[model samples]
Target: MAVLPVCQDCCQIVTVNKNGKIETHSPEPYGERACNASGLLTGRVRDIVVSSALRAHAVRRSRPTTSWGPVRVHKSGLLPRMPDAAPDAMPAPKWLPHLKGGTLASVTLPAAGWLGVWLPGYAKPTQAYRVEALTQRNVTSAWSARMECWTVNNQHFLSVANALMRRHEKILVGREYNPREKCTSSCKAARGPLCTCSCHAKHHGGGRWMAGWCVAEEFGTVVDGSRWHWMITGKA
Candidate 1:
């Protein structure tokens, strides 16, 4: 518990007891020890130092080793969560038809056969139609045979997906379609709202866009344009 002095001649150290009696042999002659030596390094001091060191070590170990592990990132709801494949993972539209009757904006696969197609400006189904956007704009009657009218944009699509997911509904995934930058406007006579087009010229050449499917349910209306907005109604 004493801080002994080094010898000036031999440069060695020596330890002494309280009565000025040399306790350990060394080449150095240390100073005499006093009665009270509580502040000097002793058992309690060693224990405290060891405990502090151990605590610091434990705290360091408790932290995450790497910042790359389990990272939390915020994501935009509109964009579909594509896999980590090549940028051009989806090939050309060899399966989709080149029909000109109406611009089938989106064909989502809610499951199988549960396709939600959006056609803005002008699309008149010659046969039956069975779909309606929760946000049907000016349509007075709900078209049981055909979709009245609907508009969708990138943001609106994401909004609808979020709403449907919250409602515990599966997204209808349509057949893959290239996105088109230009969108057609459905007429006032049509049953739906002003539809927006998902047209990316460079990616999807012939006015095509990737389509996500959804079930036709009364949840909400999504405005399609450069800035999409979702107006939630009932149990969205």
Candidate 2:
């Protein structure tokens, strides 16, 4: 004899024999009535059957969609091999060099007033800055019609430089190369022993001078003082 699942509505036990016969036992007086009302005997178990079907359908729908068909397991492993690593999980290349000792610019200002400096050309000033820069620094640049130049706050020099670096990284996403090797078209054109291309300049210490020049133009040769002013101005 084999035991079937217990009735959900009532504590009823059902057993089936090899001779194609079924026997039901009710634990409570109302068990038989509850089973009958549920149409268990008449094979009209609508609620139970429909709920199971709906659950199966939901599970099927919830599975992630992919171009490939259903996965087949093999004795070795999965059919479509999993990647060793994901793109985002890879380590980011070092781009900017550490700051050295010096003030960014050569200028004098009142203890409270803001200093103005022209934006550097290599910084690739843009009308719309990246969201990272805007949210982190709240740094904004202005175009001076009289001077015909773009100017930013003296304190926002580093933030702007960082934003430019990020932008350049995004632009040259797939073109990443080993710094010691000539990888880009520009590097090949220059016929250099090492990567002397724009990508190299943007990522390596080669462009640090430009960054320092921009800083000097904006904040002057007073790194600690400029940083202190930035903190006091509520912009830090």
Candidate 3:
């Protein structure tokens, strides 16, 4: 006996024999088992393809919707009708305190001032980061609890901490970019403005009391990782 499954998009039928092997067929033969699997995970071979398709679909669906149907423009610069909100009608971020001078300072930074050291085998850390606190200046206001420095609410303070560290030595840090296959080895993957990959070439790390409270990286690319905050906070 044979089982057939139809592709959801192409409407092409695939044949599966009793041994669970598949073959492509035209006009889908009868007297064979057919499964309606228009919306099912077929096999591991399709995981990546399916993920890419789903991502594209999400991007299409999330696009700005227009009140009117699509418009057609002519060489004369005329349109059938305005399709959506005028360019000026788009929303903007609400007013907030200037980041330059916010009282609370927190931002993820490098561990030991070194940023782009590739984990062995591109290994992902299974545990949280480990942060050690070393205090300088007045003991009365010294940072005692390491956890206090890493909370999301304390992003500003985290920035301050990183700035303080820059005064000491080169910091290891990675720049963030959507991962792409551009940089194979020497250069690491980095996010680009429009989904294209860019070379975030690592540079020498820097140390200094730079801009308000920002750690100056003298070198190394700044690739954003899923565990970036964990790496920065040293929270393990």
Worst 10 residues of 1 by lDDT: 31-40
Clashes of each: 38, 5, 38
TM-score for each predicted model, relative to the true structure: 0.18, 0.19, 0.17
Better of 1 and 2 by TM-score: 2
Question: Model 2 — which ten-residue stretch has the worst lDDT?
Answer: 227-236
Mind giving the per-residue lDDT tens digits that candidate 2 earns over 84-153? 1223322111221112211111111223323233211112233224222432455565544432334455
Q: Pick the candidate with the highest lDDT.
A: 2
Error of 2 at 213 (Å): 13
Ranking 1 against 3 by lDDT, winner: 1
lDDT of each: 0.26, 0.28, 0.26
lDDT of 3 by residue, 49-151 (tens): 3245444332111122222222232332212222112232211111111122211112333332222111101112210121222222321222213322222
Best by TM-score: 2
